[model samples]
Target chain A: MSRLSIRSFSSSPIASKVGYSTVQPVHHLIPIKKQTLGKRFPELNIPKDDIRSPQYKPKDVYQDRVNEYYQNVLKSDLLLHYYEHDSEAVTGNKARSWGEFSPYAVYRRDRKPKGLSRATRDIKPVTPRNIPELTGISINLYNKAALEESWINISARLQLAQITNVKPKVVYNKSNVLPWKVRQGKECGCKVELEGRDMTRFLSTLVELVLPRIRTFKGIKDSSGDKSGNITFGLSPEEIKFFPEIENFQELFPNLFGFHLTFKTNAGTDERARTLLTSLGLPFYKEVKNVQ
Target chain B: MWKSGLRKYSAAASSTASAGNSTSISSTLLLTRNPVITADVSKFEAQYYKYQNELWKRLMWTFPSWFYYRKGTISEQAFRELNPGPVFNNPNIEFPRGRPVVVHQRDRRFKQELKLPKTYKEVSQEKKEGGETAAEEEGAKEDNLSRQIVPNSRITKADESKDLASLERQLSRTLYLIIQENSKWTLPTFKEEQVAQGDDTKDSSVTPLHTLAEQGLYKIGGNSINYFNVSNTPCHVHKSESTREYFIKSHILSGRFVPQSESIKFLWLTKEELGEYLEKDYYKEIEHLLSDI
Candidate 1:
């Protein structure tokens, strides 16, 4: 058990706390000892050759159907593969319904086309169960200077996000999600382990969850730990029951969800990232804001 | 219908360079994660291999540990020790056993090594310390170029001239023109206007599916289906009333993205919304199951 040192490949040091992404078998399996993300991507700052810029040429109008055919028939590799089955009752239930929200493909396409592999047909779609839920939380700053000092906040969240089983997806959007209609209850559809299930439970759970966890735990600086300070963990609805607020909203949100808690400190960077993290009630970090 | 078309394009691409190497260039021919090809691939096998390798090359960005991260089972005791917390309400939910979370792995390293470029800091430091630009760097280490590559999203691009509304309009119009040319949709405004007084019957000519496809907003009989993929399998059901109707129904019914067929029949769905559905496949069972009662 050697300490994981996360340093950028650059001659300049890239230090961050260590963490792992846990997925069910057939996906993310961590080794006994893990290397830091920075080490894995030493070339983070470098530019590469053959980075083809997409030439987005508008195809012929009549080609729309052909394009549509490609989109539907040719599924993207990013699609979470799932095995779908149902009793006709479930099928009938499904039949009775129309449009769905998440873009999970019914039939998972192969990573590559036929011919390249010995048996392309042998490849099966991963069952819905196989897909891991990831939770993302973004912290945007009202102040430009705060946002610019990224490592201060990014490192903190990264450490918390990496505690163990929990997987974190981070983004820097002025707003947390796509500029579309927000969902009703759940935080995210990410296939990652979460802290609390909802807003209320999150507060209590954080004290419980992170308190026991120790790693020479310090806030932004080594001297100032979260002894009297606050740190945020973006939460989902299913995790809310663990919150102290659950008693009030129990009936409303039976399914506990995770909440986004912003760590507040009088520290230079705390106030900014905290304000941003706390406002994120649900676990959302994919959306990058369109600010000037 | 698309098979011949794709094969044709692949063949054309095959002709440009040595068929051996051409496949390496346009390698990311659209595909799913399984990386399995299903169609006839005898003629373009080289191209297919290039596509496969290319896809693996790209995925390295998102999940670096895809290759070489061995998954193992953590015993219940080990699991508890690692996650000394309360049990989840869902009993079936079991966490992974062996691997602690490590973000980067061999594959990601491979990619990093593939796309390295000198940073301004590096250039500046070198200049201060006595050095030259990329040409000098290039002459010394060509392979090092791919070492520390960062994706575009990480780099802030200053260009966003297209506003949301404008982008939306452009997208919608793009969809409109596409549907018109591909489908048997006939526009009457150009054919004959009332003011032209040419022919009332001719001006009225329209594809039957136009009404359904044109509107683009339909609530699944019970769900909100974002998109619909028209299957032209028994021949790409392009143009013709029944095909259009079938295409609409295909979006509503059968297959992985099959939505609640009930509400989708006449659900209030819009064209732009449908474009999203077309762009991405919706996972029905898992996501929909979490819906609020």
Candidate 2:
């Protein structure tokens, strides 16, 4: 193992602004000359730039690396599809076409040349402007009445970033809750809304690896879905540990907290949303019957 | 620094007190916050039923069929000329106003294809150079040949005496195609699979039932085919022919069966249906192993 770098703590004595004395226990009472501790141990001296310069933090560095990975590796034909009209966003659209996995399902709709005497203004089967599909995933981390430590919020943000493979934004309280000691604009937790390929990939991992490994999980409850079709589920701290990314590196996260995961589907009804989720291999359980 | 230590101790005590107070407060706060977790059940019921009622109303609205119109009408004449009521144009025959069907349509205009993840074979081939050296080429060829246990040429020779030996052993595990000949249902009869004498039989280590099952006997055009065995193992093997012929029971996991030959008119019937439809002699012969027909 490498020896501890003295430069890291060379300036610590100066920071204390007080010297320890064995001969004179009451050094504060006795007059003494200021000591240059660095002169005695030159190896302990760190460069001025190293001590005072503002540098990118470890989380920032990791976030940059993740962004690079998302751009170079994850953003490909297997994930993102580029439109022909918007070429710059697409970047040579023909090169990275969806190929066999194109989302648009086409059908030949033969319409007789329409005129003033057309039977109906609308086309057959009603060609939709957009298809019903998974739009995004919203993950909310709720920290109950704990807003004092910025480090906890930062760690939670980093944890979410690590799990989602995307940077998370810290959420602040919109209104003050006097009893809970929550003040308006105080950072409480973090959230991440993933869309496009990232959304699908995160969902796939949750369905295939994460949920199956969780012992206490009994599938998404039937009553969990909102009236508008979005389904929400809660994971306990123990269940969060089952995520393969976190499970493999337990030491990195000392206090892993759970979050509420919401799947935002374009399917208008709960039944269609359930069907879509089922197709993605997420099992749904029937509501438990209540005793009379 | 000595004075700061005393200050830090006091700060820590205050922080712990606050933490304890917050925890207790939040617990009580949760009772009021319960509304945030639970959803409105009656609202969901209203929304779900509203969608269902709309779907039911849509289902009642039928498409205007050209056949229902008068023969002299323009719609009927156009329908006859165009013939646009789900022929080869719409092979799936999905109802126009029904549930949305998702299809994967390949865009031929896209010429530049992105690289897919390489397989082990491809990685090895790249390491050896693009020419595909003799050893690797032979290995690939062997793999391809092995995957096809029964060659197309041997499909006709499936009923030979040499092949029948293994079929009789695995009779309870194979699926036999029952055909309707002159309105009388009976199991499909196989002819001999032709092979040249001393024709590389050394390479083939497959049983007759596996070989027969893989063949395109009841051909499914273009669609991929797969087979899986039924799990109801019979106590006794059923054989109709005195020559000791036997067949295994299996199901088509995927693919639709279209007849390769005009003479092959088949139906997938249950054991009881087969018992009712087939001749008494045929049904009686296979009665013991008719749990899954």
Candidate 3:
């Protein structure tokens, strides 16, 4: 109560008049809460990750076999597989600097990377500490039907949540297009980012159960990467039904949504990422377009 | 870098000089059975995990029974009967201790313990009630989906009986296949057939190291064994005065390794056990190649 009284007295206009100053006192744009004002309420200021914090949540609940397999078995194998006699880091096209004597060059950014708008990452040789591994998976669903009837997106969100254990965030349209009927601020679909145990569980389910069950499903395309370590592939609505969650609860979901899955890795290069994904049980196939 | 270059040059020169003697190239099989179960955690680790799991359960959101079981349905009633509501925070009650903070049929202070209604009849319950005969119970149609999910024991019969040769022995550690040939325990190595000097036939061509290892594996341990070779390229090389043994890593996916010959003896052993059984110097040299887990 004493602390609260002192806080209230400090904020009053008369408190400013007691102290002489050259500048006028400015009020905070946002009103400060009493709980966050004083050092006495240290519990409120504690980080959420700390055990004493009210919002603290436990993370490592069980052993992850996929991560263990990578650590114990795959790490050394990858190092050996990628080993070359006296290999060096293959550097990418870096940005060039403007002349230092130029007056316009002062406080200016360097020119864009050669032949590309964005700079690419260097492809480093695989070592014991830098073995490529799957970091996370991002699943994005774009529902065209939701552009007209927004209620249809709820089912898509629920479907994604059912398949992946994590709750998905709703994606919204960015620009307005009159012909396509796309408008800004409209809820389109959903996306879910999976990491750690969730990522391994989703990967195993996709490889062992889902991918093999699809009749027309070939492997992911050989040319399906962003040149960096991220690889993306899409599943059809018909093939999405192969998921066990949707197969069992078919009646609950009427319209299945086809979504794109992007596998993110820290392998530095797409080729290494592909090899890592193959070792983790995902296959890649080359597409033969023409045979004359 | 210069040192490595020098070593490589020296090795190349030595190999050329020994060309007259013809160094024998052998493929060593490093076939292993991956751990079937998660690795065993230490006592402290187990305790920490348990504590974290308990905290997770305590802080978890209340289970939405209203969504799964309708408000006025038979299944809802059964669920309610199985899981009784926590003590309500009544304004009329005179309390000596702290007041109960109840929300969504749960006490916020304690972890919610829910007992779900069982879908299938348990075998123990049937035996206790003495309603069905043992033969009748066995003959009943078993629906896989409706059946109770009881995990198999991690410790198999082979482990309990201390069967070293059984593939089912270790559930949580990698098991390597080591064979005893001529009273010496070593990794199964297959040597290349010496080619005739004047024979220039396609049949007498040099076989790849991985192929040699595969054929040798099948020749000794029957074709029923299902395995996956990690890569065609050799992972490690051990060079001696006469022979160069290249290690080919592989994993036994399924099936068993059955020794075809009477004299050949094999045992599935972990890394530490391999050290005890194998030659001291050989084990020390290949220690980094073996997985501790």
Index of the highest-DockQ prediction: 3
Alpha-carbon error at A204 in model 1, in Å? 28
- In the order shown, the candidates' DockQ scores are 0.01, 0.01, 0.22
Sorted by lDDT (best first), the order is 3, 2, 1
Which 10-residue span in candidate 1 chain A carries the lowest summed lDDT?
A87-96
lDDT of 3 at B186: 95
Q: Over all chains combined, what TM-score does candidate 2 have? A: 0.34
Residues A1-292, candidate 2: write the lDDT tens digits: 2322211211223222221111211101112233544477553353423422221111211112223322322222112111121122111112222334445523333333434223321111101232335678999998763476655776676578768966677788899888887889988888899975567668768877889888877889987787456999988888888788788768667778789999897655566577656645678998769768
Better of 1 and 2 by TM-score: 2
For B180-276, candidate 2 gives per-residue lDDT tens digits of: 5466655554322433334313335222432333442433222353444421111123343222233434445455455565665665444565666
- lDDT tens digits, residues B21-58, model 1? 31221111010111112222345664655664554443
Over 4 Å off, model 2 = A1-130, B1-293
Winner on DockQ (1 vs 3): 3
DockQ of 1: 0.01
User: Candidate 3, after superposition: displacement of residue B228 in Å?
Assistant: 2.8
Candidate 2 lDDT (Cα, 0 to 1): 0.47
